[model samples]
Target: MTTATAIVAGHGLALRRSLPLPNPPGRPTTVSLSARSLPHARRRTIVPVSPSPRRPCRCRSISSESSTAASAASDTVEEDAEPAETYDEDEDEELDPQAEVCYLDPDADPEAIREWELDFCSRPILDARGKKVWELVVCDATLSLQFTRYFPNNAINSVTLRDALASVPEALGVPLPDRVRFFRSQMQTIITRACGELGLKAVPSRRCVSLLLWLDERYEAVYSRHPGFQAGTRPLLALDNPFPTTLPENLVGDKWAFVQLPFSAVREEVESLERRYAFGAGLDLDLLGFELDDSTLVPGVAVESSRAKPLAAWMNGLEICAMEVDTGRGSLILSAGVSTRYIYSGYEKTPAATQEAEAWEAAKKACGGLHFLAIQENLNSDGCVGFWLLLDLPPPPV
Candidate 1:
């Protein structure tokens, strides 16, 4: 067999031409060029190197008669030598046409029709796609108001109590105060008002429990006042005592000793109570005590000035005993304490002893659902002061 080669620079390809073979694996026999062939014979030439890369082509001839047949075969071979288009996995992945073709079921139910909505509304969304696609993930979120763990001087970081405060707005309400003390007063008033509105029945108990009741009433009141603790608008009065409730070093005398409540521990206790007692069960405050000493400076208004003296004195002298459950709204707040006489009874003096008894009975019934329970007590420092809040529970199973 005879072969010829040529480089196709323009097409970057090699062409090959083959001549007819005598037999398979046979040795070639050389023959002299004829005088006629010498006149027409063309010398092979090497092409100059081109800047562009190219492939060389080859040609072969077996005999003069078969040369034409070889040329014809070469032409067919040239067509076969065309460059094939290259395929790349990386490029294909990037230009995946199927990506835009969503395969979601058309028969699927609408998102709103589901029993529960799984929302990514609060989650961050993607922005762009490329070699390094951009994504927006939720980072740190900020609270509009500043706060800290309650009880600075104690061991317990009181997150649960602080959160409880945040939850109570009716007892806490509007016109944000600049100072914490003022905030406390506003909260206390809110609590008292709620107790009054709820008509919580009162027992003679320590004032501390009553204070707690006030706190609970205020919490319930906010539900009616602002509804939800919505933002972007003014926040309804919400209770939040970030300050630690521990005795300060100044009070404890260089001693770091403090009786504190850890937020986690409180949470566990609350959860356990909820399971054991019932959903929305009243929190146990038996271990908790409030001792307002003379050194403990009260802020906000003067009692005769702020009408807080009776409330303050009651608070300082009392210790929380226990919470009781009543009807409709559970009596979450209940305790007994020393009683003091007040100048005003908000009742008329009657000569008939029976009339006074009847009035007292009516007064007791009237106080049944009043949420806030406040009283003036000439109670001793160690005397118990009872307070109570109304908890509206789900109706008991029949």
Candidate 2:
């Protein structure tokens, strides 16, 4: 019998059947996104490599004004911008229930999976140690911008965020500063509208599974409207390796232990504990360098509990890393420490992209393989880093 998995929907956590199921095939469309709303929204963004949860290879920027949160939003719209469609808050008609729901089946696999490279930092415009990143957090059916406080001194702006905008060349011929301003405004509006459409809760870690999907679609919509978004060279949306651990054996270990931003001292303490566990388990973990990149898993989002509550209630039980060096590079990085079990760590590091990918295949040979890991080095977009991996593991927990 298949083990039951928990998925967050219908307001809270709901238990559902778990299996490697692909999304039901849908009709092909000439354009990327088929809008359910936002009449003026564009939908021609480039998704170079999207390893969607159910939609193969389909996948998911952050910057700020004073807080990476721009002070003044530009009234200027995209050159091809259509008049904003009015949202009818007073409408009594029922909302579309089946509208663009991003279901993250943790048991599913992705096609065209590749190792996400961390090269954007090297770009003169993107070079940085710890830039402020943010994400949209929904709790109790409301938006939360609590994390904005972390960047009280929001003097610094993210280069990639600005450059990605620059890639568009300009937002409606507006100055770059104005473009950033509008970008923040539009992002907030877009995400707010998205939560209502998808019915996601305003809680920590719960929205992780679906937030990226919405952004990925939004990226295309905005890009299609842009004048010079080329077909090649990175996309606006970034995604974590669809499968973080792939082992032949199906071993569903404990629920995710924790996911949150930690101070350096705390991180070091955790690392020390993790190392002892790995060595004692005889996993003989390799000493890989750690990432200090502060870019969030969902850049530009500010997730926190409601004003009355704090993060302590739900910070644990989630698997996330905010300070890892690679966090800023592409999409989220889901690390499972070095290894969960010595027996599963049988595969040696291999060269050549395709061949090395087989390591995940080797791992799945065991049961409940959710926490398995393959090693990779820090990478630039053009080339793979030293022994760096293009990974495939089980889907991220909802």
Candidate 3:
């Protein structure tokens, strides 16, 4: 198969040819979207470069789910410094597409769907061709406002945490404030470029700021006025987060450090995940927690739903503990949960299965579409078919 590059150079992309291009590997290529970086993306200029397809075509929309992060990381030297020599195996794995880029699935082209309109909603639509059929895949959002991994910093940089703040730019001679600003700016660029490459809209700056400030301790002042932390110190009148009960006790430190989650912004994103062929939510929604003086969170979240017992942020004024607190000395709790749903799609009268396409659709409906984590299918001892619909949230970020 041959491939070609279709760089998106401006606010809107113009079709060079009216022909189908190879799908961007994982997402929908049904429509054409303008390819522009976020406004701030122009500053630090950490544009994410997407993989090009081999077909001859203009700037048609394409899907390159795996390309988002790699593309962004590929162009940077600064981002290279913070992460340790090794990346967590989980994060190292190819991320869920919808969990990464925002997509608008209209069965039309740019001529039908206007640009600004792309700002609002997009859905998965099915159209039939004479003899071909394919489904769209998920990609990371440009702003990641809907993306969950960045928040809840549960996926800790073991190397950076080992030395407390070593990842901070200040450790390298740059002023604390300036360095934080620079990183934030770059994050904005990554989000925008990530979205652009995948044929998604840019992540808004406001959402970007929330993620940036939440990740960088230097900007906690921007936290919402009513985080509703159950035991948070600021009298009920204060806006910041309260102390969470899930944290382990006095292993010891005065600082309250739990992963931060911009749920208000990401909930919608999580709800928009794709279910066909199997995908999970915001990669297990980022759950928030407190930071220990010596221990650190790995930078991820635990999403909890019905099947799993949900822990309240505060249990009657007392902090609720998430249980584990000792992970070889250098770990913080950042757990997200996912409720996975699997449908039995098979054929064998000896067993009752949902029957291929019907079972698949049933599974999609039974599962939370884009927000599932745990799933199971079993044939009862009596040979009766049984399906287990479960909610799987990752262990509180470890």
Best by TM-score: 2
State the weakest 10-residue window (summed lDDT) of model 1.
116-125
Question: TM-score for each prediction?
Answer: 0.15, 0.20, 0.17
* Best of the two (1, 2) by TM-score: 2
Q: Tell me the spans in candidate 2 whose CA falls farther than 4 Å from its real position.
A: 1-207, 235-344, 347-398
Model 2, 273-343: lDDT tens per residue? 34422211111111111122222111111111121012222222232222111211211133332221111
lDDT of 3 by residue, 1-398 (tens): 21111212111121221222222122222211111111100112112232222211111111112111111121222222121112234542433322322222222232222212011111111113221111111111221111111112222332322122222222222211111111122234443443444344442211112222222211121111112211112111111122222323211111111111122222322333342213232322222111111111011112221212211221111211121211222222222211111111111221111121122222222222211122111111111011111121111000
Full-model lDDT for every candidate: 0.21, 0.21, 0.20
Output the lDDT of residue 4, model 2.
21
Model 1, span 138-196: residue lDDT tens: 10001012111112122222232333333322222322221121112223433333333
| Rank list by lDDT | 1, 2, 3
Candidate closer to the true structure by TM-score (higher is better), 1 or 3: 3
Better of 2 and 3 by lDDT: 2
Residue 382 alpha-carbon offset, candidate 2, angstroms: 48
